[model samples]
Target: MFKTIKNDLPASIVVFFVALPLCLGIALASGAPLFSGLIAGIVGGIVVASISGSSIGVSGPAAGLAAIVLAAIVTLGGLENGGFEKFLVAVVLGGIIQILLGLARAGIIAYFFPSSVIKGMLTGIGIIIILKQIPYFFGMDKNPTGDFSFLQVEWDNLISGLLNSLNALLSGNISVGATVVGIIALGILLLWSNVLAKKAKIFQLIQGPLVAVVVGIIFFLVTQGGSLGLLKEQLVSVPVPDSFDSFKGQFSFPDFSAIGDKDVWVIAFTIAIVASLETLLCVEATDKLDPDKNVTPTNRELIAQGTGNIISGMIGGLPITQVIVRSSANIQSGGKSKMSAIIHGFFLLISVILIPTLLNKIPLSVLAAVLFIVGFKLAKPSTFANMYKLGWKQFVPFMATVLPMAITGDLLLGIGLGLAVGIFVILLKSFQNSHFLHKEGEDVNDGKVKMTLAEEVTFFNKGAILKELDNLPENSSLELDVSKTRYLDNDIIEILEDFAHKAKERNINITLVSERGTVENPPSYIEFFKLRPKAS
Candidate 1:
């Protein structure tokens, strides 16, 4: 772990900056107290990171959960009396369900997803991040929430906000001082590694995000005077606890009385499923990006995430999952082990406890600048180039997953659509090749019915194969040869069982042959067929 310090330390700083605003934003979106987001962020990082087996994956309060949290609060607490504390109870129950899933080893479901769909998911998320962060960057903060839908803003609200900004510009209500400093900070971030740092080699020691954040803080301080047109209110302001005890008092507990409510179970199950899926997907993607090409243990990761969520929820934190954005940043920043993830968690814990006031001094616009860069990196031109190079079979699913995710605001729904399309493609290939022929009695005979196995068969193949077997004429001689087959799935074997039962009704003779063996005896087909073990 110590050997990872060089990479992990820098990576931790990047994740810390990325996570800060998200914590606040997600909290704001969830209709929860602003401090709840910080609590979630702290727990997600420190608690989840400590337990997760993934070297590069980062866990946090996700934007994805904001909608659920908000809805649960509204429904369970009653619209007028809705309290965020009730929703916390649902999150705690969700964590318990997640732990059960991990013990059941259900994390292996992630392996069934195609690589194309996974790539599409990352690209879709990247696009959403870019679009959502634009308003924040431009200082337009009147939108309802950060839900990942393509729903348009209310026409009146959008027009009014634009007009308000325009009027503010004319009346000098806008902060020219903050805007100027933000531009300079963005410019420095864009060029620091390329121009200034190279020219002054010693400056290279500072990371870009650290520099940008530091410059932003200094700019806030320098422009705090009345003459500079920067108001203290314009800066990022987190709630400051008056003392250590006051800060500790902010922690919340789950209201287990609500656990008996059916609604609580529904929300809990939703969180468990979505959070687990997201964590598994992130784990897979992060492993792909790891320079060392290390493969994380998926089941172990599930266990870690489950443990994290249980802890996080118990302590008033939001549900935790392995987040792709932070994990990708970790990989890009040269993280070599889980130490980077663990350290970032510690950073979150330290920052909130020791420097809450200091954090409030940084500008929200500067944090937006950091996310803006990250969003762009995820949806870069090179990503498109690489996907296109893989051809339509890959690109179609990628787009099918991405486009819907961007439009519908549901990650799982989009991937489901993509998987549906992928399965259709496979079936088309299978149908085109579904033919078999054989020579019997020394030549082609009138009593022989040929059969062919689909290119690949699974449990889903049972119906089609069974249908064909049922249609065969009585007293017919059938030869089932799978010599040219690539995959003879287990579902097809079940279909064969159906065929055996029907053999007496049709008065049919059946023969089975493959690369390994041939079956002549009616009752010995299972023993006659020899299958090679599938390659791992």
Candidate 2:
């Protein structure tokens, strides 16, 4: 663990920068107190990281959960009572349910997802990140900076925001200094991995996000002295607690009184299911990005996320999950172990406590610069190339998942659509060639003993094959071939073996040649035949 810490610390800084805005942005979007986001971030990093089996995955408040949180608040809080505390109860219960799921080994659900679907999901998220950050990058902070779905914002509002921005520029309402800083930050970020960093060896020692943040602060300082059109309102400002005591007062406990409400349970189950699925997805993606090929145990990750959410809810934080943004940043920053994740959580805790004022001084545009880079990596050209190379079977699912996710507001819905398409293709292929044909008079004495495979040969194929064998005349030789079969599902293998035994009792000889394997019904019979491996 200590060795893991050495590699994780630097990566932790990168993840920390990536996570900060997301935490606040998700909270803002959810109509929850900003501190709730911070609390979730802290717990997700520290509590979850400490227990999670993942080496590179970073957990925190996710934008995906914002709608659920908002809806739960409205439904459980009774519009008048600010059911915010009741929502917190749901979060706690959700955590408990997640822990149960992990124990039940439900983490394998991640494996059920096709690789194309996962890639599409990542790409969809990348596009969303870029779009959402545009407003922040341009200094238009009126809208929440975390919405991934374009449908969430009306066309009129989008057009108006763009037109108003141009008007602001013409009317001299835009902060030229902030804009300059934002542009500079983006320039530095773009060049951080390029010639500038290579030429200036000193730049190699600093991360792009860290440098961008510092430059943003310096620009703010320079402009603050003269009030040169750059105002405090123009910068990113999280809620600053007046004192340590005031900060502690932000913590809210779950209202156990709401446990009796069926609505609360419904919200709780939703949270648990959504949060766990999201976390598992993040874990799988982070592992793919990890250079070491370290595989995180999904079950353990669920348990860790559950534990963190429980703690976060008890302390008045939003629901937590393994977040891909921070995890990807951690990987790109050379994170090697869970230590980076743990350190990032610690950073979130310490930053809010000791440097709240400085955090406020940092500009949103700078964070946008950081996120832009992260988004670019997720949707990089190489990603597209790799998916294409995987062939149409893979690419189809990838595009199906990506396009729908980009258009639809729901991640699961997009994936469900893609999976449906993939299954349909599979079924079509099965139906087209779902048969095993043996030549009439080649391997057998007569054409009467020829064998043909079932249209759908599952484990249940055993019964059908056995019944066919039972109908065969005694002392007859049969040629059973499954060369053109589309599916040689597992159950069929067992059935074939059972038929082999029955064939011996009837003094019947059988030859089995399939896409899977060759089986001579008589153990003493010897003939080589081609077979195909089972599907993964």
Per-prediction TM-score: 0.74, 0.77
lDDT of 1 at 315: 72
Candidate 2, residues 488-524: lDDT per residue as tens digits? 5432453454456656766777776666566666353
Candidate 2: global Cα-lDDT? 0.74
Return the top candidate by TM-score: 2
Distance from true position, residue 217, model 2, in Å?
0.3
- Model 2 quality (TM-score): 0.77
lDDT of 1 by residue, 63-135 (tens): 6676677777888874356355666677877787887888887877765566667777888877777666544
The list of candidate 2 runs beyond 4 A from truth reads 4-6, 78-80, 147-175, 196-202, 225-228, 430-536
